[model samples]
Target: MGSDGSSSGVVREPLDYVGVTNRTSSGFSLIWDSPEEKYKNFVVTSKDVGKDEALKPKSTNKDSEDDSEKEFDNKEEEAKYEQTNKSESENPRSKDENRVPESVSTPDPQNKSGTGSKPVTGSITSFKKVLPGSSRFFQFEDLPPQTEYTVTLLGKGPGLLSRLHKLVISTGPEPPKDLVFSEVTENSLTVSWTKPKSPISGFKVTYTSIKDGEPVSVSIDRGDSTLGLSQLSPGSSYEVSVVSILGLDESDPITDFFMTLPDPPTDLRAVNVTDTKALLLWRPALAAVDKYAIVYGSGTDSELRVTVSANAAEQQLSGLQGSTTYTVTISSQLGSNESSEASTSFTTTSGSGGDGDGFGDLQSKDVTPRTARLSWKPPTKPAGSYRLTYQTEGQEVKEVVVDGSVTELNLSRLHPSSRYTVQLQAESGGRNTAPLSTHFTTDCSQELLNGILKSGEVDIFPQGRSGPPVMVYCDMETDGGGWTVFQRRKDGSVDFFRGWKEYIKGFGSLSGEFWLGLDNLYNLTSMTKMTLRVDLRDQDEATFAKYSTFELVKRNYKLIVGGYSGTA
Candidate 1:
């Protein structure tokens, strides 16, 4: 505070604690603590602020400038007077005068003819502006942070007098605010923020994935408020933080959380095919999904839908039509949303649809040099009849047609000990199933019997035995087809079965070294021997009865007569 421009016997006290507090990036709180205040204008001045600063130099160097201005004016006047005294026609000066010694004609600063100009005065601070204030405090806003500001508070006093107080203060830079995320994809994210109140050097964006446990950071210029982060993990949660920086100081950070979507399913396929059922499988989602949804159908009108657990990678659909093509769409579902669809198509096994053909097992036995016996039942599908087509080397195809009721056929005229390709296909409604194929060769010396195996049981023997051989035959039969032939092991354990279908039909193998028997033949007495003979008592009926066993000897193989031998 100050008094009027008069020697009045009065002393005015200064406003108490007139300073700044609560300094921020762009502003600070200015306090004028005086209770009684009467002023016309509040003049505020902010000096040049820097990180490392001493006292700011004065704005104008007046004293030295005034002295230099006077000297320069005196010289300029002396040169002008000399030019006026000499014309183009003036006599030459004396040689002594022309050769005047150095420093003899120097101008003096006290010359009355020189114009003495007063040096200009400038304000002492870098940034000065007038502000309005009343009461005890004035909030000084919009000042730069991280800088040194020497602010002088001024007030108009009585008459032409003014009161002032000089202070050094600076505001802190503003921190970035309201960070948001957009355009979030499996591998990247875009984040944006609102600019703060004051200018800053830049911003520091720090982000980290919770699943990966790694953090990344980048610097953004002051002109840019958005940052794009790339190379991120899919279906992962991340935390992002944005902070404003001014010089070496940084504002408090603002943070947010987000997650990337899981990738779509890949490599979809079908398996375990049947007329009415099929199994569907696919690779798991690349990232993660709440669950999976499948839209499947032959077409749009009959579309069907199903849902699977998030971790499930496969599904099975039943009640499908045989040989009918189906289209399936799979998608990764997250929350209330689902990803783009991945599609695939497949057709069920054809030939048989609905309950057309029942289950059946095929087997073969009694292979000779020129003939092989093949037996089957329960058509994969119902059909009119069975056809056994066969041929030998350089021979015409010979086909044997039989009623659908028959199940066994003997393939003849095959080459001796030669391989032949065979096809077994199920037929229904004039449509043939894709043939199930096999290969077998005619025997060299061994002979086998021909018979139907509808009951899953059969008896085999050589055609008219004449000499000792390496094999023995068992002609046992069962009601439930319970007695399966057992194969003997070198260790003496009958743990394996002789698969006759494997040997004759080329389904598998049965060597001469393995023993054969019905492990559980409930229809026969334990180790009991039986024989039968065929007879026709009526013109329409033919049946078989037990026959007597023949006493045969062969040291190479002891043939056990344990099964029926009958004619039909």
Candidate 2:
């Protein structure tokens, strides 16, 4: 290379040189010729510059060079150091009032090493280099930006035990103010702040729960990006704070806030019914106000309406088709204010003609000793089923439901002499007809029979105390004898017996056993004791005879009369 500069400044000495024998890709030679060698020698790649002459200061140090180096160092420091804290007081100390102006102006770099020289620039009112091995809390203030101010540094040991040190302070810009965290949620949050007119990136949030004793930090990316706060439990309160991470500066911490989630609703219910109208009723919700919306249909035809109010306990919806089922729902309008809808179903009732004979005027007839026949007329319309019920006095009803129309019913198991009421109701198309009642009684009159008298039976005799006593029994031992009796007469006249008169006055009483009977008559057996009497009568006279024993047997018998015959 040739020199183009002027006079004496141009002759820079050229050192004795040797040519390289081996070359590298970087255009550097690993081997150089040695002046005393006939062979080549290799240059050491790893060299140690020991603490001897190697560290000696360059003898040609220049004020301009030192100025340039210092300037370059200042620029590098400017790029690396950022303001993290800005201390402010309304009134600043006057220069004359300051004990030392230059010593307390810069903050110590929290992390310092020999690799670089970065001065924390802002005047410190009181500075303590947390000794290389020790840490202690410190406080200070800085003047407002653009203000010409001087600061002094005085180091105090822990617990104010050590003397003040002569430390220097420098100034560049104040650090950014603390960041604020608000509207924190399980997964994300909003951060806000004002920087100290210094450079900085966006803010970050560091959080931990009581469960996670250790804190976890998140860098809040700009532009509403969602930070994953996933896997968090609902209804839990979390401690969270935000901090601003300046380019290469310290982080600033803010105060913490908490948040929680809402709970779910419980005990939902619904009930459905069918009248001419189909209505739905339900128990109210505790977590939210609910409105009822009915959805009614069979399979394909359906209708929905939200006409029901929150305060209304019951609602009637009309114009329903017969035998049709409808589904109903009660729900909430707002999502956060919502609950699960309750569901129910019902079938509409059918209509009946006012004059269904099968259900009108039930009548019980054809009564017997143990049963009664109940009869009714058929209904005008067809029925799905029929229910006939009856009851005794103060007794439960006996009921039967049949599939078809049954007009006449037989009710057995009735008491012999009892009355019963029968009621009939008809069910058609899910509707029940009105009931009718009638009463009937069973009969009891076939309980009387005839009795007969036999032999060994005795008969009671009639009293013979009349004017001419008659005999009830007589001796029948004679050849032509059967049961015979005698009449008596008081007058003694020959002509008294002239016509149709018996005149015998005396006849001995027969003592032998005899039979007494009459035509169209059977034996009489109720007579416990008996007596015999005889009566003999003529036209004017009559006599009486008495027997010692009375006979009562079923045979022809003869009787004796008194010993006189008036007619002869």
**392, model 1: CA deviation in Å?**
44
Give candidate 1's whole-model lDDT.
0.52
Q: Write the per-residue lDDT of candidate 1 for residues 1-568, one digit (tens) a residue.
A: 3532224322323445565555565555556654344554344445554532655443444664321011111223223323322331154453422332231222223434212111112222354333333434444444444455665555543322233465555456568888889987766868999988777899999997785556788988999999889766556689999888877666667889988765567545555555677677666665557898898998899999999997777899999876566888898877754666767666555544433354233334566546787665545546666555554446576667677677777777566544444444555577655432233445322232123233222332222122222232232343222223333233433334446433222211233334333322212211112232334445677555433431111221222332355554
Model 2 C-alpha lDDT per residue in residues 172-210, reported as the tens digit of each score: 233334445555433344545555454445556666654
On TM-score, the candidate that comes out on top is: 1
What TM-score fits each model?
Answer: 0.36, 0.25
TM-score of 1: 0.36
Among residues 3 or more apart in sequence or in different chains, the pairs in candidate 1 whose N, CA or C atoms overlap within 3 Å are: 24-172, 25-172, 25-173, 49-148, 145-171, 357-381, 366-448, 502-508, 531-547
C-alpha displacement of 436 in model 2, angstroms? Answer: 35
In candidate 1, which residue ranges exceed 4 Å CA deviation? 1-169, 172-178, 193-201, 211-213, 221-225, 244-252, 286-289, 300-302, 321-324, 334-342, 351-568
